[model samples]
Target: MTTPNVSTPRLKAPAEVASLELNPHDLSATLYNNDLAPTTRKGRTWSSYSIFTLWANDVHSLGNYAFAIGLFALGLGGWQILLALGFGAILLFALLNFSGFMGEKTGVPFPVMSRIAFGIRGAQIPALIRGAVAVAWFGIQTYLASVVLVVMVLAVAPGAAAINSNNFLGLSTLGWICFVSLWAIQLVIVSYGMEMIRKYEAFAGPVILFTMGALALWMFIQAGGSIAWSTGEAKTGADMWLSILGGGALWVSIYATFVLNFCDFTRNAISKKSVVRGNFFGIPLNMLLFGVIVVMMTGAQFKIDGTIITSPSDVVESIPNVFLLLAASTALLVLTIAVNLMANFVAPIYALTNLFPKHLNFRRAGIISGTIGLLILPWNLYNSPAVITYFLGGLGAILGPLFGIIMADYWIMRRAKVNIPDLYRTSPTGTYFFTRGVNFRAVIALAVSAVAALVLAFSPAFAHLSSFAWFIGSGLGAVIYLAIAKHGQEYKDVSGEEIAVAPTH
Candidate 1:
């Protein structure tokens, strides 16, 4: 990574330097520098492999495989499904590039990036929303992962089946025990902070990938070298294309939510190149390869069972070798938990901290978020299709527009320049201190775009548009914010000169 320019004035308050006409060339480096503790300088440490491994873990999970196969089976032929997967992956790649650029340029986390659009105090709005969503997902992913464990244990010890007979709120006693155990394990991993999390992802990523490959190869061989892609049901060209497009769009949007927040991790990267390279390999390549493997496995399973099988657990259970099934299932459970902890768990910890930096440190904030997830367990939100659709769709809608507004404000309005110190200030002189630390323009844009997206999600008349909600929300949010900012009144210029503050020890 390029070094931040040390010649720039050291400001006590970031707002004091907001008006300075900084060279656009230094913008990326400045953003990157901002992500680290002020005590740590650039190039002193790097995390390229750690970041790359995080993606490996994220992509190689059972949930991802299930989701991929489900998309393919969305009434589309194999070729059409492949097209959709490629299209979705490409869109995701582009989105990640945009968001990741901000992190590379400014070494700040996602919540910190929100300050540019939402204002310092107002940033809490997005932070809280994002963090809450992450927490819910964290719980769901953990629960799903634990299911594999339950299945594996019951296979080995038949007595454990009784654990599932007694139920509470739709979940069996064994389910509850597994959920709590998984939750506790995640909490323990997160308590050690990002470094430990990074290490775990790195170690678990390769193992999961190798195991998945082995399972796929074994399944294909068991099918006697005649693995047909045909599902036996034929469809017209138009119908097939539509299915592919719709399925692709949904899958893309599902993953795209995190692209906006990718800087939360990439800001710790060793170089902008590393971030870009990792994303290229991780998003498109990994997703495409994974999709193909999943489809192949699905086809093989269909031929064997004479019915569709979406879950990896079901596929494993069908395997003749009990030992192989147990080993693969165990690996999958570990893989799922690793990804869940890293992607869904750590995100909210940092975001929640950004909400109340003075009061909530990282560890406490993580616990708080995790606890909220646990509280929602009684609702059984994870199991309901309607609930899952609304929850994921609603959050996905907001994420797109919020990302658009932030990117537009930073790259277009501010020209990639940020008064780092002012980002945390509460004074009127602060650049982000617009109307009581709130940017009405951004709020209005968010509201408008979010409304549009929600309408598509819930209203049957607009149902077709639901597939592309992310693009619509983000584009409209950007346009709306830009238009408002163009006419909005300006305040005092606090740009160039540095304000005095003690260096962080």
Candidate 2:
């Protein structure tokens, strides 16, 4: 009797099977490292309070102080500045949640998250833009912190000012010394990784907050227990409205870099509730508290002396007690380090690693990033308040499109669903491996939107609109991306895949 031939079921291809089981923790070196991989359960330890203190430390820096007070130079009254802060804080809260939600859901860093929107290899473009901007800010913050150190030294020993007479690379000998010293201190702190950074932030934020409150109290006493909040030069009608709007734009611009890369921090949070709660308290409420303290201190300083003191270092320099000066100076030092690490250093580390995940890990990337930051000589970029304002506007223009593309892809096109395994895959079998591992839709969208924003930011005819560059760019980016992507295969490929949700406790 002829037996019926039994046919074996066709076996799935090896690559296909592997793709189905591509665990984030076991991803290839070219696509993953300990630093760039999705956070493990143990790694997701940051509480709501931890996230709150992160903002607290980041907001209370000398550079941020300069940024906030610089609005006064543009003709905003203390009350207007506070209003702007609130407005910007609301904008920041929304933008951060858009980006932070991705991290909270996926437990991945910003560069890794970009892979969903931009292909695995194409992710490098946005990463490079972010890294370069981060390096510039890192150098700028380092220089700002060093200025505080220089002020402290000059206060303690007036003879240190002699070093200023011999200038090198637009900075004094003492300036170089202080800059390098602070740089090293930050590098040492970064070497301990994110956990140490979080702990340090918890300690640093409260110290600076306390010091700022005390400083404001002392200023109130010096001003005979009253502070006059003045409207500078009396702007009314469109001019006043414009100034207020610009001031709000400046507030957002100051935090634009952090907002874009907030996933780097939020991925470590224990819950989305933690991220949202922390961000609310950290941004809107935090900005309110910080803005009031700042206005009080600066206003009181103006009352005591006819000149406006915009710099925190200047405020500390004006203090009469040597002990308090020393204490305040030390607190400001902590302030700068915390903000620099939180805002500047951490971003580029992950970004550069994303560029060469096989060759670079976090520490190596940090070293390279720090070296580039030092070489750029950021003091040149930070000359005056006008320069700072324009610089941030231009930066926001470039970065806003990225934020737009990311938000659009995730929330609109993909409907908050990310293919976790595909994010690390470079093979065409992976959904994200479109166009030989590049998503030209995202590339084109970024290019077109950023160009438009840049024109608005730099054109003399559109100078009044420059302050709105971030808003304009981000809005244009999202709209353009949505328009372009709707016809693309990536948009159609959206399916109900089982996404690996991070445990939210």
- lDDT at 6 for candidate 1? 75
lDDT of 2 by residue, 342-437 (tens): 888988999988988889877788888998888878898777666555665566568878888888888888878776766776667787788988
Candidate 1 overall lDDT versus native? 0.72
lDDT tens per residue, model 1, 117-225: 8886678778777777788888888777777778877889889987889878768988888888988988888777666676788888788878877777877887875
TM-score of each: 0.86, 0.88
Q: Candidate 1: where are CA atoms >4 Å away?
A: 1-46, 168-170, 234-238, 487-505
Superposed Cα deviation of residue 280, candidate 2 (Å): 1.5
How much is 382 displaced in model 1, in angstroms? 1.7
